[model samples]
Target: MIGQDDSRLHTAVLVGPEGERRRARKARRQAAAKVETDARRHRKVQARAKWEAEQAERRNTSYLPPAGEAGPAALRTPGRFRLPKHQDTSATLAGQYPFLAEAGLGNQGVFVGQDLYSGGSFVYDPWVLYQRGLITAPNVVLAGIVGSGKSSLAKSLYTRSLPFGRRVYVPGDPKGEHTAVAEAVGGRAIILGHGLRNRLNPLDEGHRPSAVSDAEWAMQVASRRRDLIGALAETVLDRPLSPLEHTAIDLALRDAVRSAEVPILPMVVDRILSPNTADDEDGRLAEDGRLVGHALRRLVAGDLQGLFDGPSTVRFDPSLPMVSLDLSRVAENSTLISVLMTCSSAWMESALSDPAGGQRWVIYDEAWRLMQYPALLRRMDAQWRLARHFGIANMLIFHKLSDLDNVGDAGTAMRALASSLLANAETRIVYRQEPDQLGSTALALGLTGTEQKLLPGLGTGQGLWRIKDRSFVVQHQLHPAELAAFDTTGRMTSDSHEFRNLDVRSGIPNDRRDS
Candidate 1:
């Protein structure tokens, strides 16, 4: 009876409100577990069904054989197709790949000729190139062997530029080649030599630009005269002037300026040799300028006397389309040629300084000869460096690139200057080069092996133009009239072709026979 009472108490506690809530929660958990189990079973069955469908579809599909189709439908060889691996530089690959030629400089410049690789028209203008940011420097270095059509190319370049409002100035023409072209284009060529009547007063005030003030013009004239006299003295001395010599020149130049309206070379020579009594206090000034005076006297009273001694007979007209100083008559005397070129270059500089003078082509023909003189080389270097500022393009024409190597000793200042001329000139036009010059030319121009090799095979009128980093092989085209005007081999070809007297003012050949 006691055990039955204890069991009834336990059952009563279990059947209380808390026990009832626990039973309800247990029932909900059982329902959720059954729902989750049904969902998992459903997912498994769906996966199985999808797998069976894929297996059936895969069995029905057909694929290509490992060896490809057979008979006439066969597209593969009997053996495995394979290609040998190849590798090279992009430069070489560019040439090997078809349809990879350069698009070339656009057609806004002067029409030069066709690009060999691109088979398209190749036009070039340094100013145009500079304007378009194709080149930084407006100077150009052109080298070629004789009969390679470099002269013709140069003539064509400048003459073609004339129609575009650019002027041509050949500071010195050693062979008188440009005389005809100058006159043909309505320009003047100042013919100066031992027997010629043309006189250039280095001290005379040169062409003054319209923009410069009178005070600035006077200062420029003074500075140019002083420098011109010093350069001439150095050319005659074949060395640079010392401080004492410069002082002597300056004092004597001042004295000459006060005494004369337009001082000629002789007047300056007189003042330099015999300085004023008041100026030479210690009597040492005479000795100081003795060597310089005697050196400059060469231009006034010595063998170089007749050319620069007197006042101006023919003036430098910068307004003309072109102006060339013909030095062919004095070609045999290299020293005289250098001296005359110095004066002519000075005259041209005054015109170049004029911002209103427009664009001009300053051709340094027979550059090898000009490079021999340090004074001239320095002047040329200055002009080249200032080309962009002066709104001009300077073209240096030479026989070979190695000619610059012969300028001075290894690592000398003159050599550096000569090399700088090449460095500054972003445009390099190389015509047919002799095989012996390949190594040095390639080294100087930074040409690739292929470009270097191409040098030897270039034909006449065919040049390898390296404008900045880009390259093009151009075949220069010329008109029939240009061919006749630019021909330099006439003397060798025709026995009757003689240099008749040229009109003093016009530089055109006349019937006046050579006296």
Candidate 2:
């Protein structure tokens, strides 16, 4: 009984300390739990207040309708935007979208007219284009049917260029269309024909450049005289001269120059017909030159005698703003016209070769007629090829591009030369064409279907300009004074002269326009 009681006391003492320690740990854990619950409650209250404020702000805020803002601020309509369906060419569509059209040749050149597509002022200057690297060839090929106002456009181009210090030279004006323009521009028109007093001595020493030495001038004159006489003979004979015939003509020319102070065609012809005893050592020189001599005699004593037999009554003044050889009076005689052109060409060659002669326009007005003669065509080809070297721009006006087809047989060198003219000219202006002419014209110029179609429907003064690969539809605008001066139908329309004083811009006097 005593042992049991001792064990019970020890157990009671240990149990009492353990119960107090366990109670203290439980109290500390309960205090931490209470602190965490208070912190969580505070966070929940702050979050609820923030959410309520955001909800209040949202309830008061305004918003746009699904249709968009009303009145002037509206950017969208309630209904779908629609229009009638349309279809047209890209060329026409470009007008609707301006960015689609060409930027156009800049406004730095001469004012030509309006660009139909871009609705802007169109300007063109071959020299300006060349300097800007837009074109390598300064030559221009202009083809248009009669009554297309092409003549007026041509006149305006060169005349307007006069103020820029450029000179004009019309080598052969078959219809004398440019005569009035030449005279009006303070230039001379040498009118030559059966009855005209103006004689063109082919042997005349032409305008000598300030840069040429006396020796060089003499040599140039001799070479030109020889070439002119030969070309004239060839044009008449309608064939090239033989080698022996050339030698005979050379001997006769040398003798004539020695015997005369200023040699003429008659002197050359006389010597060719009857060779000097010393020069004709073989005694067959007269026989050799018989055909050539007679061919040339046609100029001095034959049917074509009057114009080129004696000294020139008028001289070609290169310093003039313009000079034109008016072949209108001799238009009926094709041979005579060709001969006269040959002489004029010689004069032109001398002046054109001058390095000091500023940039000039060499206008071949009736290029078709001029191209018929082999000699003239060859000379033209040479000049055209050397256009850039001589600082001259040649303008070849044709009735149609197909006129080139008649230049020679299809595959001949003559035809090739003719083709090269158009090829070398990077600027081609095509005016109104007949319906039938479309194919050949398009083929010749490599025109697009749209461009070809545009040709037949073109109105007066309107043209399709092909500058290199780019294309332009232009309406050639003319000043009132220009229209009056460039009137080619004066004889056809009697009222034209009477209405000449009227302003063409309004088709009435400026005073009457407001009335």
Candidate 3:
């Protein structure tokens, strides 16, 4: 009986041990499965986060803000990281804020120091502090590459300034883009050419004679004496004209123009080209004089009547905001056209210098061509000097940095002369360019890191804009119809019923004959 009971206990102990081992194995398997499941969940979360980050980058790179949408301050990041307001006033004081934004004024108006933007976007709102007021400074230099939309930007600004009752004059460069703006804004476009009749009856007979007095003629003749001397020095002395030499030449030219009985250009040319003048002058001066003489003679005899007479041909109502000189027809004579435009500017400045009741803006497109001419350079220099007094604001546009260098040493001097204009400009806009040009442009405009980064990505009509205290890149949205209205061919086509119906003639008007 004892032996049987012992056997039963042993059997029970073995069964209990087996059951315990099985239970341990099951728990181990469950633990391993939970670990695997956790691993999978973690990997899925990481992948989702990575996907979100990639999506944000794509959005930032390709997204354009909706028209009229305030520009974004911060780019989106992965997950739920909230960002502060994009514009932080921490650096800017609210009370004496230099920036002023007035959207109701002519589409959109932003005044930064002397820089003005019309039809500009809210993206540019951060740059309002940089514009210069008319009373503060006078010159603006726009440097960009071709097709960068510099001309379009200038035209838009000019049109915007119109409602403010500013007198705007545009030189008739080969690009006649400004003419459409002038016509649209109720201003006249004066086309200067031979046989063109004056639309404005400035003279009693509707014609102004080209003549000067005997004393004036004698003074003009005497003025050629310096040019003759310079020509003699350049030809004989083999020297370049110094600043003093240029000044003397200017005085001489002025005398000749003021004193001449007939057109002074011929006499001026004759004096420079004379053999005696060359003999007494250095070879360089003589060469330069000959070049000048040839250039002047061609200008005078050529179809340059339009530039000198165009302003008088059209009566400018002070109430009108814009005036464009259309010179597309004279493309063959671009240099001559530049000369004419310079002369017209001088005439306008003289007329507006004395208490012109309001402010004015004068824009020069393809300004590089004008830089090639000494007379135009001098005129621009004068504009810089007297901009404040005349309340005249000037915007000079160029396509390349090298273009400025093409105008000789005078170009260098002109660049220096333009420095004040650049410094005083309240706003500076730099469009996309080659990599090399990008650095130089950024340095010139004093852009920050954020602003600099925006340059490479900017599209057409987009650029880095610098105001006084802050800067950013913005895509400018312009009125497409207004932009399309100006033809690139420089011809005001009759396709537009309004432009066709106008009784304006092509070229500066001559004295009217009884018609």
- Which one wins on TM-score? 1
Number of clashes found in candidate 3: 43
**Runs with alpha carbons beyond 4 Å of true place in candidate 2:** 1-87, 495-515
TM-score of 3: 0.53
Tens-digit per-residue lDDT, 1-515, candidate 1: 99999999998987797888999999999999999999999999999999999999999998888887888798656798899999897568877786787999999879988898888999898899899888999998999999999999999999999999999999999999999999999999989887778888887788999978889989999999999999998999989999999989999999989988888877777878899988999988988999999999988888888878888899999889999999999999999999999998898889998989999999999999999999899999999999999999999998999998789999999999999999999999999999999999989999989899998899999999998898899999988999999999988766444333456666666774343
Instruction: Indicate whether candidate 2 or candidate 3 has the larger lDDT.
Output: 2
Runs in model 3 with CA error above 4 Å?
Answer: 1-138, 193-295, 302-319, 400-402, 405-415, 418-421, 486-515
| Poorest stretch of ten by lDDT in candidate 3 | 200-209
Clashes of each: 0, 0, 43
TM-scores of the candidates are 0.80, 0.79, 0.53
Q: What lDDT score belongs to each candidate, Candidate 1 first?
A: 0.91, 0.91, 0.55
User: Which pairs of residues have clashing backbones in candidate 1?
Assistant: none
